[model samples]
Structures are given as structure tokens and as C-alpha cells.
Target: MTSAVDVVVVGGGQAGLAAGHHLRRQGLDFVILDADAAPGGSWQHMWDSLHLFSPAEHSSLPGRLMPAQPGEAYPDAGHVVDYLADYEKRYNLSVQHGTRVDAVRRNAGQLMVEADTGTWRARAVISATGTWSRPFLPATPGREVFTGRQLHTVNYRSPADFAGQRVIVVGGGNSGAQIAADLTLDGHVNVTWVTQRPPRFLPDDIDGRALFDVATARRRALEEGRSDTGGVASLGDIVAVPPVRSARDAGLLSVRPMFTRLTADGVRWDDGSHSGADAVVWCTGFRPALAHLAPLNLRGPRGHIPTDGTRVLGEPHLHLLGYGDWTGPASATLIGVGRPAREAAHQIARQLST
Candidate 1:
């Protein structure tokens, strides 16, 4: 059985919720499908010590400001989960939890959303399925033969799991830096942090809020036919959060060049140097979680669905929200998702009216 709606939002995480807010304002009939049984989305699975790069006031959705946690400069993962749950309730958004979408394809003039629970036919589809589920692990030689434990950022929970082991943390992104710092803080594990390039740290004072501002400026410059001033990338990569800062200050967060291959017991660098390790953690980041959209055949050369803002190129009825800056300036972040969400909702509303 197919239930018809004006819009069907896939993935009820932060991005989905933001789109829901704007869609409701447009008075559109829509349903948000979420795979998670509860409201927190991926925040529920973040490592125990994870915290936002910005304060609560700066990180929020369209309708409400995230309430600040007392005495916390940066709200932790638990607070974010609580906020998302409360945000869903506060807005009364129509979210169908535990319904994982299997595929999305065109049926007649509308898009058919096939899911675990049932089906929905909608004039427009919004794919807000973020990258959390698709952790990327680089193809290092001899990785298959490695005898030690291997894990990705998605599998990380706490430093306790790797306690007393010699661990090598890979990648140079925020996750890699944070996890390396986290392990150092544990004081039980011997950590060797490696990256493909030298790790870049933002100024101690710079946070997500500033990065968002830079992204906005860079986006405006590009759209207006001006020279690209270079966005957040110009500042640096790592956010220099409190924990990372503390560990770096203590000389516990030293980084080395990435290893060229994995050995039976450990890893080997390009210079023929080797280090033994009991475990290896890959914080290499994630690709967009768009496997369900494979039937659409919309992927481009870079393995991404080409888009004009949030709207997918060549598919006017489909919008891809919250993938990253490609979807919008900073659409992947909590606060940054609002602009793109609103634009996508407005566009969908206009398309439906015609």
C-alpha cells in the first residue's frame, strides 16, 4: 500500500528535523522516516568524551536555540542528544521512527520510498541521510593480514576499550585528532598518531561558529562571481577543542607520517621504519550515506549526486539535504543546516504548488 504525501524526508536526524521545521511552515504534507528507534540520531553513538566545537547558543535548529548546559563551554554529546529529542517534541514534527528506507525510485510522476515498515509516494523526496553510517577506511597494503584489532570512528566508544594496548590512530581530521587525544588522556594506552599530511590546528579561540561564518562568506563570494576567498579550509582543519588542546599541550599528541603498509603485528612507514601495535584506529572520516539512492543512477564522476543548492541536478523532484557544503554552505553541521533546509523546503513547496 502506498500512502501519498507532498514530501517524504529520508533520515530523521538533525538535517531531517531542520527540513521538517521548514516544511511544516510551508504547510506541506510530509513524513520524516528515521532508522533510529529514538530521537538522538548519530549523536547517540558518538564517543563518550565528544563535545561540540561551538556553544549551545551557536548550535541550533531553525525554531529553537539549543539550551546551554550549566558550566559547560561546549555541550557534550549527551546534551546534544537530549536537545534533539526535545526539539522533535517541541516542534511536533511528524517523524516516523524505526522506519529505514530501502530504496527510492520514480513511480508514475512521484517518487516511491520503499522502507522496512511500508511505502510512501511523494511528489518530492528529501534525502538527509548523513555520512555517519559510512565510515571510510583507507586501503593500506597488508591491512588484510594484520593480526591486531582494527576499528573505525563509527566503532569507537571510549578509551577504556583500548586501555593497556599499543594503538596507532590514523587520519588527520578532527575525529583522528580527538580520538588520539582521548587515548592519551586515558593514560593507559601507548598511542602513535599518524596522518597522511601534517595535522593543521585552528586558533584556540576559533570554533564552529567562526568556521560557519567563513563558509558563508566564501559561498557568497563564489555565488556573486567574485574570487573565492577560501573558506574554513584556509583557517585549518582541527578545531582545537579543550581535550585536544590539553593533550597537545602535555606533549602527548605528537603526530607522525602515515604508514605505507600494515605488518602482521603493526604498521610500516615508507622509510622502512616499523612500529608494533596491538590495535589500529582509523578516523579517516565518512562518505555520504546514499546507498538507498543507487537505483536513481544520479551519481557523478566524484560519486556524489550533483546538485544546485539542495536540489539534485536533472531531478527537480528530488533534493539532497545535509550532505555537506555541496548541498549548502555548511549544511552538515547542526546550526549550518537551517539555511539549506529552508531553501529546499521552499523549493519543494513551489514545485508542489505548480
Candidate 2:
């Protein structure tokens, strides 16, 4: 049996929830399809020690402020999970949990969203599925020949698993830095953290809230036809979160250049130097989770769907949210997703009305 609605949101995470909030305000009939079995989205899967770069108040969805956590300036993953669960209930959003959408395609001027449980036909579809599922591992030489265990950020849960082992952590982004810090602070594993380039740490005074402000200012400048101000990228990459700062200041977290190739038991650098390791952790980040949209054939040569604001270039009926800055300024972050989500809903409402 196929049900119909004005809009079908393919994700129940922060982006999808934000879209739902605006769609509700717009009086549009819609339902958010979440792949997860429960609320919290990707937050629940984050490593135990993971914490937001900003306070709870700065990291929130639309129509609600995330409540403060007592004695914690930066909330951990568990706190975020609880907040998301509460946000869903507080707003009474219609979510079909555990319904993973397999495909989305056009059918007689309407979009047909297919899932294991059922199908939905809608005039507009919002692809808010974030990048958590699509972890990107770089094609470093001899990776296949490496005899040691290798895992991506998605599979990592805690430092206890690597206790007493020599591990090499790759990548220079926030995840790489954080995981390295976690392992170093845990005082269990011997970690050799590597990055493609020298790790850049943001100023101690700067945090997620400040980064968001920079993104906002940059976005506003561009929309008003002003020169580019470089935005968040201008400052640095890593946020210098508490753990990272502690480890760095104590000289426990030292980074080396990326390995030239993986060996049977370890890695080799370009200078012919070598190190032995029991495991290698790749925190190389992820691509957009857009496999479900393959039927649309909208991707460009660069492997990304071109967009005019939130709307897909070739398919205006479709809108993508929370992938990255390409979708909107800082759209991938919690506080940043609201603007694009709101705009996407309003655009969809206007389109459906006509």
C-alpha cells in the first residue's frame, strides 16, 4: 500500500527534525523517515568521550534550546542523545523509526520514496540524510597489504579496545585530533598520530559558537555581494577542545607526517623510516550519505549533486540538507542546519502550492 503526503523527509536527524519543525509551521502534510531504531541520530554512536565544541545552549534545533548540563561547559555525546530524544517528543514530530529508505525516484510528477516497510508518494522530498554512514577512508598505498587491524571512525567506540597495543591514528581533522587525545589521555595504547599536513589548532578562546559566528558573517557578506572573508577556514581546523588542549599542553599528543605506505606490521614514512603498530585508525572523515538518491542521476563530475541554495540544480523538487557548506553555511553543524532547513521547507511549501 502506498501512502501520500505533501512532503517526505528522508532522515529524522537534526536536519530532518529542523525541516519537520518548519513544515509543521507551514501547515504542510509530511513525515520524517529515520533509519535509526530510535531518536538521537548519530550522536548515540559517537565515542564515549566525545563532547560538543560549544555549550548545549549554542547547539540546538529550531523552536527549542538545548537545556544546560550542570557543571559541564561542553556536553558529551550522552547529553546530546538525551537532548535529541527530548526534542523529538517536545515537538511531537511524526517520525517513522527504523524505516530505512532504499530509493527515491520520480513517478508521474510525484516522488516515490521506497523503503522496506512501505512507500510514500509526495510532491516534494527532502534528503536530509547526513554523512555519518559514509565514512571515507583514503587510498593510502599498501593499505590492503597491511597485516594489522584497520578501522574507521565509524567503528571506533572507546580506547579500552586498543589498550596496550601500538596504534597509528591517521587524518588531521577534529576526529583524528580528538581520538588521538582520547587515547593519549586514557594512558593505555601507544599512539602515533599522523596527518597529511601539519595540524592547525584554533585559538584557545575560539570555539564552536565563535566558528558559527564567523560562518554567519561570511555567508552574509557573500549574499550581499561583498568580498570573501575566508570564514571559519581562515582561523584553523581543530577546535582545541578540552581533552585535546590538555594532551597537547602536556606534550602527550605529538603528530607526525602521514605514512608513505602501510607495511605488514606497521607503516613506512617517505624518508624510509618505519614504525610497528598493531592497529591503524583512520579518521579521514566522510562523504555525503546520498546512495539512496542514485536513481535520480543528479550527481556531477565531482561526485556531488549541484545545488541552488538547498534545492538540487536539476531537480528543484528535491532539497538536500546538512551535508556541508555547499548546502548552506555550516549546514552540517547543529545550529547551522536550521536556516537551510527552514528555507527548504518554505521553498517546498511555495512549490507545492503552485
Candidate 3:
């Protein structure tokens, strides 16, 4: 099946939904293609214990506030999913769920979005596919030879799976710290954290709001051709979540330097000491899900296209939303995505109007 619209948005996650909200407001005829069976995107894949680092008010998408659950300080992954589902319904956005976009290309001045269910021919395309599908696992020597289990954050559901085992949580990000804390909860598993450098932990009072503010300031400074010397916390900084705080209080937050190499049984330290591990959980993060956009041939040496705000520099008709800070200031976060989405929609509307 083939259809045409003013815009076609790929990925119906928070970013795509934010873009949809603006596109609808701009009176653009668009369709948001989502591969998921339901409205929630990568949130559905996160571990059950995962909770937002910021409060509900700070984690909402564009226009609508995320209703905070009673008695909860921060929302869980399920709450976010429910909020996104309701947001899509509230706006009555045109979303084609369960449609996996296979590829996208330009044909005769029109963008063609090929999906499993149909093709979308649009004057412009917005790609918002977030990074959950493409989990990154570093290449370590003897990793393939390891006899124990190894999994990325995407496949990790619960710590019970690693109960009574010796586990190594690798990475110096929030996910790594949180998962490591979870594994040490029941005292059944031995958890060791390994990082190339010590993880940065924000003060107890700091949160996502402060980070967003700093990012916004930095963006504004760059736009004005000025230097920004502000030292602000980043998304990867540990937020001192309850579980993590408890773990630190119990002296479980200590981290080891990265191992020299992986051994069949475990990892070897720089001191030539080896520790046996039953499993290795790599919370090493992800790369953008840009396979569908490969045919566009817009990737630069960094594997990402240059963009002026959300608009692709080389292809004005194409826009990218919520990949990372490069696309827009703090665009990956729920709150940070709204401005970019709104700006992208406005740009798309103006471009198609001509």
C-alpha cells in the first residue's frame, strides 16, 4: 500500500509523539510510523526496576504534563508508557502502529518511506527513531571465549536472573550504577562495577531540570557565537536515586578500573589478578537506530548527519528529532525533546508551504 502526506515521521516514541503534537497544531497531514505493537517505544524494553531520574513534572513531553502517581516520588517505566499512550490518544495524532519502516529514500524530489505495511510518499520526513534497539557492547578480547553469560542493558529485565551469581556491571553511566545496585540488593549476588574512570555523581539536590537548563544555555551561547564555560551535570551522571543512595550508604558503590582484558573465566586486571565472573552485564548504552535512513546517504564521517537545529543541513526537507544533543540541546530526554519537535514541525510547515 502507498499513501502520500505532507510529512512522514518515523518512530512513535516521545520524540515522534512530540513532533506529532506540533505537526497536528501546524495543520500538517502526517503519519507517525511505529514498529511497536503499542504506543510506548523503548520504555517497554527497559528493566522493570528502572525509574526516571527526575520527577514526573520534569519528565513530561510537549504540551501535556505527565500525571504523577500518588505516593510516588518519581515515575517508573510503566507510568511513562501509559502517559505516552494517553498523549497520542489525547492529540488524536495519525499514528500507524506495528509498521516497521524498512528504509527511506528520496525519489523525484519526494521522500519515500518504505515500511512493512505500507509506503509513505511525503514532501518531508522526520526521523525520530531512538537508540534502544541498537544496544552497544564493547569489543573486548576473549569476550567470545567467555563461558558465562553476557548481555546488554536491552536484554536485562530483572536482577533475579543473576541471583547467586558473581556479576560484573561494566560502564560508567547511570544505567551501570543502577543495575549494579539492583544486583547487590538481596545479598545473593556478588556485584562488581568496572569503569574506565570514576562515575560522576550529581549532588542530591540536582536533577534533570538543572541539566536541561545548562544545555539550553550552552545552545544559546553557541548560537550567538559565544563560549560557554558552565560546568553542568550530564545525563550520564548518577542522580543519587534511592536504591543507589542506599547502596552507597552500605559501601557498595565502589568501582574498579576497567579490566585489562577479558578471560575465558572472567577478567584480568592490570595487576595480573583475575576474578571469576558468572555473568557480565554491559550497560554500555546505545547508538542511534538509523538503519532505515541509510539509503539517504546523509551520514558524515561521524556516522551522523549535520543539522541546523533539527533540520538536516544538506537536505532541508529532512529533519531529525531526539537523537542526541547534536540534533538539539538535550533532545533525547522527554522534556528536552519538545522544543526541537516544535521547531522541526514549524520548519517543515514553512518548507512545504513554498
Which runs of model 3 end up more than 4 angstroms from their true locations?
A: 230-236
The global Cα lDDT (0 to 1) of model 1 is: 0.94
Which regions of candidate 1 deviate over 4 angstroms? none
lDDT of 2 by residue, 1-354 (tens): 799999999998889999999999999999999999999889989998999999999999898999988989999989988988898898899999999999999999889999989999989999999999999988899999999899999988889999999999998989999999999999989999999899999999999999999999999999999999999999999999999999999999899998899999999998998899999999999999999999999999888789999999888899999987989999999899999999999999899888
**Measured by C-alpha RMSD in angstroms, how accurate is candidate 3?**
1.4
How much lDDT does each candidate structure score? Answer: 0.94, 0.93, 0.89
C-alpha lDDT (0 to 100) for residue 88 of candidate 3 = 94
Q: Which 10 residues in a row give candidate 3 its minimum summed lDDT?
A: 228-237
| Candidate closer to the true structure by lDDT (higher is better), 2 or 3 | 2
Positional deviation of residue 176's Cα in model 2 after best superposition, in angstroms: 0.5
lDDT of 3 by residue, 260-281 (tens): 8888889999999999999999
Clashes in predicted model 2? 0
Model 1, span 122-202: residue lDDT tens = 999999999999988888899999999999998988989987999999989899999999999989999999998999999
Query: Model 3 has how many clashing residue pairs?
Result: 0
Q: Pick the candidate with the highest lDDT.
A: 1
Scored by lDDT, model 2 comes in at: 0.93
